[model samples]
Target: MTTELSVILAGGGTAGHVSPLLAIGDALRAAAPGVEITALGTADGLEARLVPAAGYRLETINKVPFPRRPNAAMFSFPFKFKAAIDQAKAILTEAKADAVVGVGGYVCTPVYLAANKLGIPVFIHEANARAGLANKLGARKAAGIGVAYASSGLAGARVVGMPMRKSIAAMDTAALRPAARAALGLDEHTPVLVVTGGSSGAASINRAVSASLPAIAEAGVQVLHITGAGKGITDASGALLAGAGYRQVEYVDGMQNAYAAADLIVARSGAGTVCELAVAGVPSVLVPLPIGNGEQKLNAADLVGAGGAVLIDDAGFTPEYFATEVLPLLANAPALAAMSAAARAQGRNDAAEAMAAMVLEGTKQQSTGRHPKMGS
Candidate 1:
């Protein structure tokens, strides 16, 4: 049975949604040479730039965000939503898709519904521990669902973990450590701490860490702080902090080096970062962003509960707390090693492959000529 498979991956809005979509696309292409993969996103989302940049054909639909409150937008929601669904249906019809794999975002809901209506199988990947609204809706009719965390609360969702990009999924920390350290101008013996709040940096983490820089330096550990673009914070030298193993860059082209050189990580618990840290076997102190639906808190729960990382409230993650909690943790070699081991144990390195298999299995079922309707 050499039926060619065409899969449409629907997700966008942020890196959390788009990253996994790209990962699965990469997996499908690698695992099956002839598979046709297309991405469904909105022009307003990060996916507009990222999806095409990743070398996948991106078919955009209107951004049809669900109205949370009763208002004018809510009243017009039906017409706009139907238009988006029609757009998605057109793309699927042209691609002749066998299945849809939705990662969840503003664009995913319409695509999922359209695929279901067309009798095409739909699979889902819920990246956050707390499932997003689009994914929650998509899961009801998804032929199979893969969740990043066990606590995602999606019925019939299997814990297939977060689908990471190839570089991260294949990284060997020990092998990359020396070069990573050298590139950062760090000494081999000095422990390194990497701080980041994703690509856009977090103000709270930046302020706390910047204020505690001297104290952090006093602990005999080096630091690689990614301050994010436009954060406007600098070092004692009035630069972006480059002095004696305490380097701060607005961004790094590749995070492989950062992860390779890190003995401990101080960052927000975004689903992507959490999964990357676990896969790389890096210990972390997670200070979840205190906003939205507390998804960041949930994102850190698996690693925190497994003793792989520590969770701190954002309000309490001050310079004082860093001095008391982080500095001491840095000095403890055994604890760091144990935490690294635990993180590795929780890592699902083969998540992309697993998710790819699920997608293919759903496609295979679709080929059986008797498509089982997903939901009653």
Candidate 2:
């Protein structure tokens, strides 16, 4: 009888990490019905909720952040990191993990170390154009490395694309457009622009949209502005400042609906957002977050290069830019259609399955008395 493949999916703290982890877990379960899947995450991270909510058994360890500078935390780092690795070892031993797959997060470093020490195969997937620190460290000894962007600097990493939810991967925007608009209470014929700054909201984006709302409405374009939590534009009466052809919400539960209803998207270009826009074939105006190691800007490159997206610097994405650029783009039907096609051309919905195959392949090799090289 063939032994059941057991795997541990590690990485969390943010949706960027947890989302891919869940997608990989789902793919593994689909590929091998009897596979045992357990998730490793930090107690306080988004994974605490999302992992269980996705119907996987979750194991948590203390978060160990690598200090960038010499400080008190740096002095105590070795001990804390070891403890986290110990916790990972305990979890992996108990689950009898045949292989470990990590997306990228604070939890990944220790999980990689533990899996390595146990002589189990490790698979890594980096979701950004520039790899994160944990993933950078883990990539050195990963049995199979996958990246969502070609520019991701992890050596020997394959460009397998971003693993996303089925709702996004299988979305048929054109077919679902009318029903999606009706569900969102939007008119079927009006050009719809969806603006978001992600879950925490973007103050500059909100400000620019608020200032440009009048012009947008005048152009027969309707707006669904997803202001990040607590960032809603309001009048003195404390009510949201929404008028005809404008809607403001702090969040949207299902992004697929927004993608389906949108003629165009105006948003920050996180890796997930950029990939989703491509997969959904939505034309976009991307204003990358002005912080970090320029990963957001790098994330937008391929889509922009393909002519599916327009890239605007954060400082230049003001009300004037919105009126001069976005308004005219929304009015150009042929251009929007071409942009949609270009974006679709870059979509890869098979990433989850591809990553899952790597895990299964590693397990098969292990079972057959052949082992993947420790640093291959």
| Candidate 1 per-residue lDDT over residues 46-78, each given as its tens digit | 788888888999999999778888888998999
Report the lDDT tens digits of candidate 2 across residue range 1-376. Answer: 3566778999998777888899999999999997889999999988898899889999999998999888899989999999999999999988888889999889999999999999988999999999998899889988899899989999998999999889889999999999999988899999999999987788989999898877877887899999986788997798889876889999877789999999999999989899999999999999999998999999999999999999999999889999999989988999999999999999999899999998888678764433322221
TM-score of each: 0.90, 0.92
Q: The CA-based lDDT of model 2 is what?
A: 0.90
Look at candidate 2 and give me any clashing residue pairs.
201-228
Worst ten in a row by lDDT for model 2 = 367-376
Q: Which residue pairs of candidate 1 clash?
A: none
Candidate 1 segments exceeding 4 Å error: 232-245, 368-376
